[model samples]
Target: MKSEYLRITGGTPLEGTVRAAGAKNAITKLLV
Candidate 1:
C-alpha cells in the first residue's frame, strides 16, 4: 500500500499535511 499527502484546512483553521490513502484505495477498501 502507498500513502499520499493531503492538505487539510477550513476546520478550526487546520493547515498541515496529512498522510492518507488514495481515493481508489479508500473506495476499494470500502467495497471489500
Candidate 2:
C-alpha cells in the first residue's frame, strides 16, 4: 500500500463592488 496527500490554497483578493444573484429554483447536489 501507498500514501497520498492533497494541498489546496488561496482565493479572492477582491477590491470592488461585487454583485451575485441566483435562480429562483436553484438546486445543487454533490456526492463523493
Which candidate's TM-score is highest?
1
Q: Report lDDT (Cα) of residue 11, candidate 2.
A: 86
TM-score between candidate 1 and the true structure: 0.29
Give the per-residue lDDT of model 1 (tens digit) for 1-32. 86643343355664554334446456445434
* lDDT of candidate 2 at residue 13, scale 0 to 100: 56
Highest lDDT against the true fold, candidate: 1
Which portions of model 2 miss their true places by more than 4 Å?
12-32
True-structure lDDT of candidate 1: 0.47
Give the per-residue lDDT of model 2 (tens digit) for 1-32.
Answer: 85433222358453553222442123221111
RMSD of each: 8.0, 12.8
